[model samples]
Target: MRCQNLVCGLVLLLALGTSTVVQATKPEDTAATRAQGQVLFERTCLFCHGATGQGDGPAGWFLGRYASPRPRNFTAGSFKFRSTPSGDLPTDQDLFRTITKGIPGYMPSFASLSEAARWQIVAYVKSFYPGFRTETPVPLPLVGAPTPQLAESLDRGRALYTSFECHTCHGTEGRGDGPVTQAGELKDASGLQIQAADLTRPSSFKNGASLPDLVRTLLTGLDGTPMPSYAARLSDRETDAWDLAQYLRALSAESVP
Candidate 1:
């Protein structure tokens, strides 16, 4: 069974490719590098991050609208994407991954930039808050590859989706038009209106669209959003979480790019 699962997982991982490109070592933090990062930030990031990383650029004013994600208030130090625990700062790699992947409909990917440039930007963005220097945030330990019973897991996941009442928010078709959304009840930490994710379009997932990403999101949940942590009910059983992730993956009409 272990061998079978490993083979299945290997195939899926290969198919997914390195959606979150891996960089094993972090570059040294230095004034020159940060200076370059600042230049990059001003040129490419300032439009959304603002002059001082306040998430109040002119374009952001119109882009985020009055919704839950009206540009991140960097000074506030709250982020939607992270491998760290909720309310904790993201690791350096987490910041780098966000830059590499970008938010689906929101932030544009900076994959075109050299890895060094992206790391520099990560450093500059960290400069917005003092915690980055005083604290070293640790990423959550991720689970192993897909289970050997992926086919069986998918079936359980489909059943769990309904039993868990995920359809109440995400809708039956994985569309965002769920009852709560229709009722105008979904709100974020800021009390701004928020909508459930359209699961059918994995290509546009805000945090991430890959299967592991889905599993992690399920386990950790996005902070400051209408999304709740299933970790309470789901954590006691790891299989339940994986099954749920598989089902979410099956709902997508398009795969993650």
Candidate 2:
């Protein structure tokens, strides 16, 4: 009888240990974690994101016709700002950063929220799309740094820009007054009218203005906008995207006045 009782106690201890380990290793968004996220979304996001996250919140409608860009409709799974390739879903970190940073002119920053709460919101927002559950995000490749010779790089970039016909939409001076803009031909994936970004204004860049950010934008492109990814098009010996980024940085430095 004593031996049987000891054996039973040992088995119970091992079972409890296994259960604890499983719980510890588990990623977030269990039933309880998702419940917490749902609560946070209801309290803070419902006004702009809508109860269903369809971007049809009552407040969004009230923003009026002049609203240059409408609120994001999460259910469509089409994200504009991402480090991933065009047409790919953004990584969780990408979503988290967007939520924290927000779009300057369109969406307000949610930086006031706790980091944990923001992550929870990411989880909740991702729940709107089925692909978030089934698809794995592929990160865009990072190319080597720009060549040390600035003038040469700029020259190469300029030649490539002309060869690539970048001036058609971005203008020869990077002023966003290109032929496409003049013709009013720019539109987003939603068929909403959109303007080409004024490349001369680095401060207004939606996806950060750092060298790496610009390069990444060139490689990945902004998904829902008129921007097209150069990842596949650029040649190994031709205009390196980094050189183009360097030239763009130089353009931004030009006096705007």
Candidate 3:
């Protein structure tokens, strides 16, 4: 009995020591750790995720061929497959899952890295959205429903839409029949073949077909797919969800004629 107790005690001590070592090795989201991660990220992930984590590095150009969804624009707060609801920031575990499991069409799993390293990457990635990270209050827009002149604005929106290459997937008529459909190939960043949503058929939306909802989705973008939030890339006046909503409504209205 004494010998058996001695063996069990030794095993418990060894387990405790191992756990302590692992806990010590795990990275914390400190300034020093983030600094270290920055160096590592620059060396490894910068080419694809960009130095700014904007998902527009040179590698992103080629990514469209295989990835169905577009790479995430880290500047935007959108993340797909998060346990948290949309618009809310993802938890650390959520970010970890994305980094480890990899999002379809956007990122691949980096199983080679140790757990500590992935946490470090999360800290570094959050650095890209300082405003979002800090949760700064946004400036309120010119409030009120769009004016009757909104129709004219929709025409202008159409011009901007085409210029921005929105028609590539959203059809010329916003019926989801853009040029990519010619090959019958549609995909999101995760290498998943997907059907583009027809904006004209607003009723088809999983989210309610309300104008405000459309605007929020456009400004924030749906997480986990090719759809990107144009907030930073486009002028608020130009890409205002209200204007896009008007244009989309116009497009749908035109289909009736």
The Cα error of candidate 2 at residue 81, in Å, is: 1.2
Best by lDDT: 1
Which of the two, 1 or 3, has more TM-score?
Answer: 1
lDDT rank order: 1, 2, 3
Q: Summarize candidate 3's per-residue lDDT along 45-68 as a digit string, tens digits.
A: 887888888877778657654435
Q: State every prediction's TM-score relative to the real structure.
A: 0.87, 0.81, 0.45
Candidate 2 regions off by >4 Å?
A: 1-27, 62-68, 146-149, 235-239, 254-257
Error of 2 at 27 (Å): 6.3
lDDT per model vs. reference: 0.78, 0.74, 0.60
Better of 2 and 3 by lDDT: 2
lDDT of 1 by residue, 1-257 (tens): 78866776676566434756687456778887788899999999998779889888878877658876777767887777887777788888878988997887888889899898999998888889888889888766444455543679888888888887888889987898889987889998778888899998887788787777887677667888877666666756557877888788888767554
Off by over 4 Å in 1: 1-17, 148-151
Give lDDT: candidate 3, residue 30.
85
For model 3, the stretches where C-alpha displacement exceeds 4 angstroms are 1-26, 65-68, 135-257
Candidates arranged by TM-score, highest first: 1, 2, 3
The lDDT of model 2 is: 0.74
Predictions: Cα RMSD each: 3.1, 13.8, 18.4
